[model samples]
Target: MLKKIRWMAVVLLTGLVMYPLPLMADHQGAGQNSTLVLEPTVVTAGRIKEKKSDITTNVTIYTREDLEASSIQDLSDLMLKEGFMVREYPNSTISVAIRGFSTDTHGNDLSSSVLILVNGRRAGTGNLAKISMDNVERVEIIRGPASVQYGASALGGVINVITRKGKGPFTASLEGTLGSWDYKKGTVSMSGAVSQFDFDVTGSKSSQGDYDTGSGSEYRNTGFDSKERFSFNGGFTFLPQNRVGISYSDYSGDHIGSPDYLSANDPDDYVNHGIKSYDVYYDGQTRDDFLFWNIRYFKGKDEYETHDGAMTPSRTYWRDTDSQGAQAQITAKWAVAQITAGWDWVDYEVSNSNTVAGKENTYENPAGFFMVKTKLLEDKLVLTGGGRYDEYEVTSDTGKVKEDDNWSFSCGAVYKITGELSVRANYAQAFKMPTADQLFMLTDYSAWGMGIWSGNENLKPESSETYEAGIDYTRGSLTGSLTYFHTDFEDRIAYKSIGGGVTQYTNVQGGTLDGVEGSLQLDIGAMFGWDWEIVPYGSFTTFLEYEDDETNEKFQYTPEWSAAYGMRVNHVEYGLNARLNFTHYGRHEITDYEGTGATTLGPDTVADFSVGKELFDMNKFGKIRLKGEINNLFDRDYALVQGYPSPGRTFYLGLNYTY
Candidate 1:
């Protein structure tokens, strides 16, 4: 896999130096500026809008234009191509980790240390399956502790999504996709503004049949997936400085198959899942724009049912989870200093039909935070400091309760050495509060045939201290950055298999991770006065020293080395775009499924490519475009986990029309 990827890189580089491309001008449509912005704007790092170059944390932003140029089918696709450290498991489960933390899937619990948010509010589950790329305006990712701004579960980082809002004149769009494995999908959306009211609405449905592996054989239990989704956002500006808005999102999946491990096919295992979420918010600003405030309330719920076996004696398991929260925040600025303060409350509950009656687990958390940012040395130097306090409680149906509290702090600084170069450094102390399931769940089931285990109510919250530094450069149409980060964890949680097929929860001494990430973008249209563009990005992560005094083994799932590099090319005049992506993961030493010895896996690389073109445009009828994408283009036979092979050589064709 490595050799293949290297050869492809050579070919790409060789072609770039020799190929001759035309110059194309950029267009941002009506009421939009054509000026090129090399650095994207971001909000996840500070809970406020700012240039990525101005933030002390390592941040990445993906704009709507970026999304439209990529072969993104879902959030996972976007992350994979962007070089984020995302883990993809069977049944399309997707999770992300920053600086080598929050990597655990926990069998789809979606309660990892990483946090996911939509419009500054927590999105339940953080399950990629529950996230759809519809009516999305932008995505910002912060790569490190964000507990000061986002509270618990942000120990690793945060993924903040911003949805589109109505502006300008009315517009409509339609999109459809057809692909290998009988895949089919369609989407429709509309956005417009009327007087003081604005609205955006979208809906989609999709389904796919079974897929074939690169070995020309079918993957068992990897049956089919079908889904439906709807989203709406509307706001009314009742006053010149105040606005009220409401948003709703719903997603449903039917008969999603859960394939067996190691190329094994199972015809009888599948699940049905659904999620519904709603948000109501108000935003107001005082005169002179010195003080800005926002208040919001949100609710989200998820349910799923799994079926095993084929005939009448089949068994079934089902679960329901609910999450709700509210927040109020104020930001005030004066001169070179800005202060932000906020308070929030969150609640989560989980229940299962297979568990004992009235055995539901519940968790409640309330938090407050204060942050300050200042500029010194004539705006060449920036400083940020923040702290948060979180109080949490866990309760079970049996009347048992546990209460705990923790405080987190962060400090960062950025220094500009020149007009085009800058350096940044940050330090943070973050903690992950124990989940209700971790503290109160008593249900036990066999894990990979290893043993039966139940949650431990006495477990303590996990904590970490992280340090990061980086350099950034932006000049004309060229932009590049490199960052290195390290993290040390304490009291990390783990589920251990004891004797006699019994497992128990325990605290590991902890672990340490260190890594580097880098990205580069060049606009050929401006560099050489051509109308083309190219962006090449890459990242590398590894554990410098893991394990503790009690164990010498490396942390599970911590690859010795992982790297991803990709390049995107575009010709604006011709409306042509193409992208090539490659990723490699080093070998991992993992405990065997049968509770025996360890096994070495991975050290694999995968590549993908996509191309798109505009077919035609009618003045009043809108513009139409065609796209083709191929995943696993090399047909490499590999697995993210032992016994689970990735799909191979799949193709997709799509059409999109916009007015």
Candidate 2:
């Protein structure tokens, strides 16, 4: 793999030298430059943002053009692309394993290594709440442990979604989609100024029929998700040295019918799963030449209720979870160097999950950090360094564990050889804290009759350091990048079996991961009055052998090879868009461990498609649009999850109107 990557790099550099291309063709291309949302996320932030020309720790930026051209609805759409491991559940819910950490299963508690963020705010996971993309401006995927700054859930990486900021003329955009299998969706958005205040409101609702398992069997899928989002911003430019602005957003949604367990042949009896969430956030910013700071606070609550008909005791399980956090950050630039510092605090509470008694659970953690970024070597080389410290206390039914602390730091530098060639490298430390289940979810399934396997009150924290580097070169008509990364996890958290079916949560020493991936973009130039492009990409990851130290048996649900690839087509006017997505997975080992006799999971492939358009442009007074999308385009039968097969040939259509 290393040799192959080297060859690709040589070819890329030689090609660039042979024929020069626009350094920012995507940026200078007609019809796209005016799109502020498409601008590099660093538009305002002083940080020297990552560009396609340099790779440091795997990161992918999906532009507004890519989103619109590909007709993507959510993260699930990324499944069609290689490198991303997406385990599809009924409906649109999917657990993504970007860069191999995903174990080819519907991501459950600790099943994924990625963190999903919306507008720099913490988004809850674990069947509680999910991040939506209706008003998303762009998505930033940082592919590695971000625990140094993100915390427990950010084991793999971070997905930062920038929301659409209110700007530009008083314009409105609307769209409608309608297609197969009782699929329908409606969307409406309007933005403009009323007096000195500017406001933007965008909302959408969608529903669809239960999808098939591609084997002609239905998984009892009949689930729908809906969200209502609104934002208001007020700002004023008071001369060359002053500016202030404030913004607020609120979102709420629901996803019904997610079960704890469903058998291959008995998918009918396992029904009744639901999740609802609400979020409210407010932020304000003030800036000057020498200094600036942004302050924000977010509050989120999630309610999850499910009647797993097959639950051991037929429990109508319910859990209520909420999080509140505040952040204050300041950035300053002085003599070719920019310094950023910030502090964050968050609290978590969970109310009952398995008992109708409504028991409440809670935990609190606080963190602080500072970073310095500088432009060196005549502003062509960039270097950054930062460190973070976290302290938290977890209190549960068992008892209280206190005095826990974690530390992480990172440094990186990028060198531009020319306007078109750049090279970069980075290193970061990330980790995850113990969850409630690990600390206290006890079980009596053992003949020992409710024996206890207590939490490690004095347990040391799990830690990891990642090293990554890459070079990117692009010339006219062709663009390409290569990225390579390696991670070493020390004292990783794990559940070690004690005896008689009971297990204890503890940290294990020695875990390693290595990966290499990249993507290529080619613009065939205007063909027949149409600007066209073809993007091809792939990723590969190797999870070193992991086993129980005591028994020396392999861990469950870890696949040796995880890889993905796809193509997209777009036409600006006339409103046409489409994609051919292919997903392939190698074999994996399942739980129910019995030495090397574990069950084999997937090593399969499947394809899917979608398209949409604006019906009429009758101005902001009113407008309508139509769309159609289908999953499992080829209807190939396959299963990414153990008995639960995926949906086949799913179709949807939606309509939107605005006034």
The model with the greatest TM-score is 1
- Per-residue alpha-carbon lDDT of model 2 for 377-487, expressed as tens digits? 787888878888888776664454555788888888888899767888988887666655555555443454555555566556656688888877655546566667777
lDDT, candidate 1, 93-160, per-residue tens: 66766666653333223366888788988877656767778778998888889888887778788888
Count of backbone collisions in candidate 2: 17
**Each model's TM-score, in the order given?**
0.91, 0.82
**Which sections of candidate 1 miss by over 4 Å?**
1-39, 103-110, 311-315, 443-455, 497-502, 546-549, 594-598
Residue 503's C-alpha lDDT in candidate 2?
Answer: 70
- Going through the candidates in the order shown, the clash numbers are 8, 17
Residue pair clashes in candidate 1: 23-530, 23-531, 24-531, 220-265, 220-266, 221-266, 262-643, 525-530
